[model samples]
Target: MMPCDSNMTSIVQRIARQALLTFRSPPRIGEEASKSFLENHSKLKSLMTEVRAADLHLVPRRASDSPPAVPVPPPVTYMHICETDQFSMGVFLLKSGASIPLHDHPGMHGMLKVMYGKVRISCFDRLQRSPQAAQPGALRRSVLRSTAEYTEDSDPCVLSPDRDNLHQIDAVDGPTAFMDILAPPYDPDDGRDCHYYRLLTDAEEGEHTEQREQKEKEVWLMEISQPPEFWCGGEPYPGPEVSL
Candidate 1:
């Protein structure tokens, strides 16, 4: 096990403190951040890529093989590491064949780094809404950004308010675990809330406005209730203690 409050802070501890300083005064959406802020963000990204499951003392929590009569638990679990007003850090564990459904992080910046196993992540960017866009109850226009698999050795998947902000993650082949960092954690009162969605076919978009470019297809994503099949349980973080 890693030591806590030692003379030298572990990578996880440093990540927590750096995240605090990096997001304390984040740049406004749609604006370019200052040089110093960008520099700090770059450093943070580097640190995140360096983290491993061993550093956090994490291992995949798989569904039991002998489960005929056993009451199966939720497929996902969250291990809370630490948090501050500016940021929150945690790990999400997914059992084999489990998935975290498509969701949006409203007005936030985030990073996802696989700590173990592998995950296929599909990312999307919400397009600007027009006057003739779908009504309040209809789907929102989004553009598929990318879909890729990542392992512990991969670079972190980064998301910002306006770029690749909505995504779905699925465990590949077996159980998976990843570290998640979100700035200015979701606060419904502050108008920052999480919303779930599912991709709809182009025909379902039903848009009467401009057509999507043939090169880059635009699709619709309908807001949905959190998928009933998925839920997140909790676990204790067994890594070095993080303080900010």
Candidate 2:
């Protein structure tokens, strides 16, 4: 049976319930979550750990399969599992050398779990601005929190409304796929819309390690139009159906 209650059988269905229970009433943005909410969040993370590619009926694709006879596929693909007023769940698949450019999740919480192959994620957090900083068009001062690679065996990557809210994801070694969950799904009227960005640097081409590690840990980023080379196509979720 579909996930009409707590009696869900599939891990996917179970994850949907746990996510629903965890995010349905999360504390407001920037506010501290109560103990109960924290506990539920932990459980949700644990459940996510138990998910796998086989569980979702997803198969990894070839590293580079561009046949002239075949329709050229988008660099990335998405398999939407479910969505509600509180959150959205889906899977992202990236082809070899494909990347999802740096983007922001305004006032949202998210979790990403690698299902097949590997992915490298570079995370950033906006920094406090000063009057003298750069009026450098669309640029926002920020700190690069982390740049790490993950595989199916790795635990889910976590993001909060205020921390590590911007990131770029690239498929590593080969094609990659990951399951993603976002709370309070994007709504333009609600002021939660997606934005793309790229790093703004003073140094050109192959500058030096100095740019990456100023010890100042600060960098400038400018918003940009969606990367022309990157586009996401949707696929049907072939796994067990989930419902709340």
Candidate 3:
């Protein structure tokens, strides 16, 4: 299909519609309908392959461009596409060597599909009710779930409230960008606020460290305020408008 086919709504728009149908009425949407929506999500991934940077009005920087003399701003930026009570969708662009540090989605579910370039994502899962007192503050034990790399040709990375919900994303080699969707979006009043975390290691080094022999590596995490070095600057979404 032609990119931005004027005769039809874009695939992103179709995905938005399906997402709305899937999430708008959670209690009443039924199990079978929910399953169907997941199938739609898979189809959305397949359709994503047809998308190009130009389709989103993004112009990739050429390699020969001279580096700026002044200090450069943060290398990561975001484009707000659309949002509703059910879900929010957007794109994140990261320059070479940039990373979205280890953080969490609280109780949200998410899907991320790379649009261009590549990213390495490290994901973690919090152990249940495992908070303990530490010198600086409270720390919770967690398990390193997976570390995987993704490119435009890869499947979407999926996350749920209880699984692979905490992750760090880093751009590999050169620039990268990905489309992200979060369900029931982040609302502090609703207990879905985003939180940042740092992994902690025991200095004493005992049985806990030896447990690394197990399948999942366990570690402590300390909650903290957003890092001063990282911030997202928003840009207008330039693709076909989505309406739910």
Counted clashes in each candidate structure = 0, 0, 0
| Per-residue lDDT over 1-244 for candidate 3, one digit per residue giving the tens place of the 0 to 100 score | 5674544776778777766765564322112336665666566555555566666776665334454454766668889989998889889988788889898887676788888889999999887654343233456678889999998778889886778989999999788888888887999888677778887767733565665545447776777778888887766777877876
Tens digit per residue, CA lDDT, model 2, 129-150: 3344222247676888999999
Displacement of residue 17 (Cα, Å) in model 3 is: 1.0
TM-score of each: 0.89, 0.87, 0.80
Question: Model 1, range 1-244, lDDT digits (tens) per residue?
Answer: 7765635779998888889889988886788888888988998999999999999998655555442243867788889998888889999988899999999887799999999989999999888744552333457777889999999999999998778999999999888999999988999888777788888865665553246555565677887888899998888999988867
- For model 3, the local distance difference test gives 0.75
Q: Which candidate would rank higher by TM-score, 2 or 3?
A: 2
Pairs clashing within candidate 3: none
**Over 4 Å off in model 3, which ranges?**
1-7, 25-37, 44-51, 62-72, 130-136, 202-215
- The CA root-mean-square deviation of candidate 2, after full C-alpha superposition on the true structure, stands at 4.1
| Best lDDT among the predictions, by candidate number | 2
